[model samples]
Target: MKNILRLALRAIGVWATALSLFSAGGLHAQSFPSQPVRIIVAQAAGGLVDILARGYATELNRLWDQPVIVENRPGANTIIGAEAAARSAPDGHTLLLSNSATISINQFLYKKLPYDPERDFALLYNIASSAYIIVVNPSLPVNSLREFIELAKRKPGEIAYGSFGLGSSSHLETEYLSARTGIRMTHIPYKGVADVLPALARGDVQMALAGIQPAIPLLKAGKIRVLALTASVRDPLAPDVPTAAESGYPGLNLAGWFGFVAPAATPRPILDKISGDLAQISNRRDFKEKTIMRGGLVPLLQPPEQFAEYVREERARYSLLIKNLNLNLD
Candidate 1:
């Protein structure tokens, strides 16, 4: 009789404890942003990532009725901001607004990093994606994707391609194109994406892989000609440009993405709340018009689970591609 009583009491205590924990998580989610929230952007001010962060911050501030700040900590190829956010308290108050490089490619490029992408962060949302286009100097005798490949093949080492930096998506994607097409081109590394297009415009480099947004003005001015987009489908922003698959290279379908991530130890309830809020904001027409489409990006927001899985796949894909490229930035 005593044993039965004790077992009943023990089960009651266990249930009570679980109920308390569940209530605590619920409270945490409801009262999240009990303090001001700050988003750390790993890019300079006025860039696409920073722009998107600020736009989301505005909506988050309105939704949470709390101050939301966007802070830029750009440097070391996004390591500075990433480390900052990773080391922050795992309370969901601090978040990272990051590009694919910080989460997917940096691990493969650097042998040692201040923060571990897989271990330190929980992906909250994938905000948007941009198309990467292959552009070349208008002076170059290439009007089509096939013509560009033929030119690169004929010229071999004589043709030069500019990238944001060594081991950047621009560089690796360009290299991927070369490897697939059996062509050779010189790689000229620049400071950032902003620099690569201008260099190509001035004929400092004959070709470049750059985002469509930044290249729009240059394209309008006839400074550069787009050969093909490294995307599977043509973006609505530039529907006339053929995708690399349509251009006969199905392997170059990578797109540039931005996402929100927080420290791994954040409570599940808080993570879910933020994810839900952001997903709602992303679907708003104002967000699509003022933030995404204006930046020449498409809204590609996904649920936290889907975002996490996508990040995992991208990390694996980049790992193999970087390995094949023999990139070891240290």
Candidate 2:
């Protein structure tokens, strides 16, 4: 009788502790955003990530009836802003508009980051994605994807390609393409993708993986020719451009994506609440048409668990690719 009573007492104690924690978490979720919330963007103010952060801030502000600020901390390969977000308080108020660079590629490139990608953050959702199109100097003899590959093969290490920076998605994608096609090209590192377009037009570089929106004006002028997109499907903005898969390179369909992440220690209930709210916001037709489609990006909304898995898979994929490329920024 004594043993039975002791065991029952311990079970009751554990149950009571769990109930208290659940109640506290529920209260935290309900009372979240008691103060202003801030979203940090690791890019400049006029860039796509900043634009998305500001647009979402407006919606989030309206939804919570609280101020939502977007802060830009661009520099040092996005380490400045990402580290800030990682070290922030574990409350649900701070968010980071993270991309492939910060979440997946950085760990592989740098020997030591100020923060651990998996340990310091919990991903909320993969909000948006865009494909990089294969563009070449119009003066180049290539007019199609297959033709470009043939030219690259004919002139190994003779044709040069430009990338946004070392270890950037553009860099990795171009390298990955070379690995797939068994061709070699000189890599010219540009400060940004925007800068690469001018170089292509000037014939300083023969080819590049460029963004469609920024390349549109140059394409119209016939300065740079877009041969194919590094995507699975055609972008509405460039309906005539074939995806790499459609162009016979199914393995080259790599897209760049951005998402939201919070400090890892944030309360589970609060994380769920914020994620749920953002999922609802993402589903709105107005938000989709205005903020997402307006910028020529595709909506990639996923729940927290799904997004977490996505990040893990991407990290693993990048890890192998980076190792194969033998790239280490540090």
Candidate maximizing TM-score: 1
**Highest-lDDT candidate:** 2
TM per candidate: 0.86, 0.86
Let me know the TM-score candidate 2 reaches against the reference structure.
0.86
Ten consecutive residues with minimal summed lDDT in candidate 2? 42-51
Candidate 2, residues 169-274, lDDT tens digits: the string is 7789899999998899999976555567889999999999876776888899988999999887889989999999888888887777889999999989999999
TM-score of 1: 0.86
